[model samples]
Target: MAHVRSSAIRARLDWVRVHHGQARVEEVIGALDRHELAIRGAASPNLWIPFDAYVALNTEIDRRFGIGDLSLCRVLGRYTAEVNLPTLYRIFYKIGTPTYILSKVSAVWSAHYDSGIASSRPVPDGVIIRVESFATPHRCMCLSVLGWLEQTVTIAGAELIDAREVMCRLRDGNACEFRLLYREP
Candidate 1:
């Protein structure tokens, strides 16, 4: 398969992260969820893959390759801004980072831009809302997502001093909390 240029991919990811918006996040999340479900033997009729499975597969691949590099994981996290499944999948296998896969999924619901496709709406600030769970793997999922977000900001020529957990009201009446961090050049 033809590969996306690393620089171009990075630029696209940076664009999405910097221009985060709610609608874009929803759209990308829907797209990514659909793609994940389409994969063979994903999980169930709901078409959701377990977060742990996602992490294990990538971790296994990394172990097999004997490459302990985290660059691929970082890149995959960056790519989530675009909801580019093909690129994400390729990076998952090529770079072998479990954190990358989880971050990509979270980015689908957090980052409001599609690096693979153009959008007609304004991008929102990359605000990540974490859903707490007792599942250990799910916790890892949250960390991976935060890691990716931080990496994305750094790649965009900004610095993220700290990400503090805070509750933010969503469109729905229910309130969700995520690690809120500020960025500056």
Candidate 2:
């Protein structure tokens, strides 16, 4: 079974509690408990947890709070970047151009996920990221990545125009591809 950093799960739960209230979070936690997943309040951020549990948590969040289209997963992902990146990494975003920042996504991929290698290359107005070798892929995960990349460029002081997942392992078979277009700012 693939594993994900516990921080990912914690962040999602935190978002729910903050936005929906303690009762909603408790409800969500109850649902997850049925799946045998535990979200201890003091769980270590560096600890590893089952990736499917992470997915299940996201699925529940989307089902309860998200638009039926799963776009809220993308929003949650962008929120993750917003909340998580501005602290220690704010300087990197300020100093780097969008291209410079995006090109380094491959290096950062392994920090949050134990599966998948993200590779990127410069395109005309943006970057193309391909997430390959992901042992388990799902639509929620793909949308989250797409949103993260979009927010990343915006944080790097670029004006994002469009972003899309052109291919997904869930629908297309092998890898997931994301295209993000930006205007220099």
Candidate 3:
């Protein structure tokens, strides 16, 4: 299975702590703290965890968020804007159009997935990001990615038109394909 930086989980927890109640934030943080005995001692915020664990954390976030909707994705995306995107921005966003910046997505995504599970390419409308395999379906993750893409594009100075998943891995499609559509403002 693929792995993700624990930073993703920590960042979302920060968002929850600010917007949601403190108890729920602690609940999620506490759960991760208890993910294993050794982790309780001092898990590096940058440590890598299985992608499934990251997904599970997102699901728990939705549950405790009390809405259990794609809005959680919006929240995740907004938070991503504050932290993740800016770092990438400094590296990739040099007054480039969204298309130009997005052309670098394959590299950034590889750094996140840390495996060969993801790829991105420009299309007529925007971009197509593929997760080659996901044993389970996760709308929250998809939506969160969508939201992140939207924010990232906007930060790149593009006007986002729409974004959606056109193919689902669980639906027996070849891969989970997220289609993004945007245009320059």
- Best model per TM-score: 2
Clashing pairs in model 2, backbone N/Cα/C closer than 3 A: none
lDDT, residue 26, model 2: 79
> How do the residues 1-185 of candidate 3 rate in per-residue lDDT, one tens digit apiece?
66767667667767787787778666775675435332232256567777667776677777777486656866686576657555655555646787776666677666665664667788987988787764455676667767777777877777788887798765768778878898875
The candidate that achieves the highest lDDT relative to the unseen native structure? 2
CA deviation > 4 Å runs, candidate 1: 1-46, 65-75, 82-131, 134-143, 151-181
TM-score of each: 0.33, 0.93, 0.81
Model 2, span 1-185: residue lDDT tens = 77777777777878898899989987987887644454553288778787778778888899999876777889888877777774668888988898888888878788888888998988999989999998888778888888788889889899999999888888855789999999977
Model 1 TM-score is: 0.33
Model 3 TM-score on a 0 to 1 scale: 0.81
Listing every candidate in turn, what is its Cα RMSD in Å to the true structure after a full C-alpha superposition?
A: 15.4, 1.7, 3.0
So what's the TM-score on candidate 2? Answer: 0.93
